[model samples]
Target: MDPRARPFRSVLYIPGSKERALEKAKTLPVDAIIFDLEDAVAVEEKPAARSLLTETLKAGGYGPRFKIVRVNGLDTEWGRKDVQAMAFAGADAVLLPKVEKTAQLDELSEMLPGMPLWAMMETPRGILNADALAAHPRLEGFVMGTNDLAKELGCRFRPDRLAMMSSLTHCLLAARAHGVVAVDGVYNAFKDEEGLMAECEQGRDLGFDGKTLIHPAQVPTANAAFAPSEEEIDLARRQIAAFEEAEKNGQGVAVVDGRIVENLHIVTARETLAKAAAIAQLEAST
Candidate 1:
């Protein structure tokens, strides 16, 4: 599937070992579900988790939500099995954790021919190699690993994430340069609704395509944060109409609501409309 076609405002991570969570996720409103066989699962449970994910994908009633398998990093023993299982299970993508270099991605690309790879950029090494990793042909996107990054840098959470903004933006720039989706890390405090919403807003403003969610409760907030506002949709429509009219009149640019509108503005408007349409369709089907 074309990763760019989907609206991934909230990608929820469900522990692969938890049968209840996996079952419940089928009905959640999130754009995608990452069946985590990595940090969320214990070492002893890795084998079982892999089996469970394989069976779950085979059963196949996940509706419109995109399915991804978060495999353990290639550095571990379980990582190779995770890739083999996920690839044969017919998952939409395989999320590679703790990826520090493009060579690691190249190795996985050879193993899983057609499956897209979403690399985790959580370590200092990963962040430093962000550009090269993003430029990799098989790398479809990056998921920021904020918790590990904070630990590695000895940074404190000031509630605003002021210290990690540079790293966050750097990843964003890299993803944008390569036309790849960049997903923000999860907020650990699932019960804090206000804090979650604030962080979701912060991620959106920082140009993240979506936020990785830890709980089902955070899904609505994440969806709302990344969705275009009514005002934005209205303006997009106006700009599109103005541009079309200008083209009819043989003009290169048009004025919309006192601002100059050009071909680029129309392109943005089209994307906004497409996203809104996709969201509406998803909601209607649910």
Candidate 2:
């Protein structure tokens, strides 16, 4: 599938130290997996975890799910080693934590040429520098680290995410402007199914490609929420049909849902179908 057309509905984070979770991921319905080597792994276990992920990735049974390795920042003791190991780990992309500047990406790209990098928008400076970071040629996407953002901002965590709205919107604009994928932050309350679904819906409504997942239970909801709904697909089909029929008579617009649908609307309508088709193709491939 074209990388642009691929869905990022459920980008689940699995701890690299957990062997069982890594194996179980092969059967999950997630669209992507972030093998966490930073926050998720302990200090003593980093070496073993790194070696394990490297070996597992080389062995290869992840199926169609996208595999990404989240590495520590270059300033840390194990950061460079993590990057070196992941350079040949066969993972799809390498995720960098607390990316605050464009130069940081340039440096990482220099270290691992030809490898795609994903940035974690967690710090205040990083959110402010979103434009430059998203504009990088090798950046595949932005993963909102809301947990870190909330901690850094010292703000309350509300279901509406009122405190982080500005930062979220900033990152979203940057990602969309550069045509790079933007995934919403993870919901910390892993057991709150209702909250997770609500947040996924909110993210989808806010133009995010998907929401990050901390657990397997969140996968189905994220996938369903991010994809186009049946009603939306039907409306898109009708809009295209109506618009094409109107154009045959030299008209430039059609009416649907009691509103005017112009040629520009056709572009969106066709894109909706295309997104749905791409998702179906992904499911078929899996």
Best by TM-score: 2
TM match of model 1 to true structure: 0.95
Per-residue lDDT of 1-286 in model 2, one digit per residue for the tens?
2355788989999999999999999999889999999999999999999999999999999888999899989999999999999999899999999999988899899999999899999999999999999999999889999999999999998889999999999999999988888999998888998998999999999999998999998898899999999999999999999999999999988898899999899998998999999888888877
Could you tell me the C-alpha RMSD of candidate 2 in Å?
A: 1.1
State residue 173's C-alpha deviation in candidate 2, in Å: 0.3
Error of 1 at 181 (Å): 1.1
Q: Indicate which candidate wins on lDDT.
A: 2
lDDT of 1 by residue, 1-286 (tens): 5566678899999999999998999899989888999999999999999999899998988988888889998889999998888878968889898899888999999999988889888898899899999999888888988999999989999789998998899999999999888999989999999999999999998889899999999999999999999999999999998889899999999998799999998998999999899888877765
Among all windows of 10 consecutive residues in model 2, the one with the lowest summed lDDT is 1-10
Instruction: Name the 10 consecutive residues with the lowest summed lDDT in model 1.
Output: 1-10
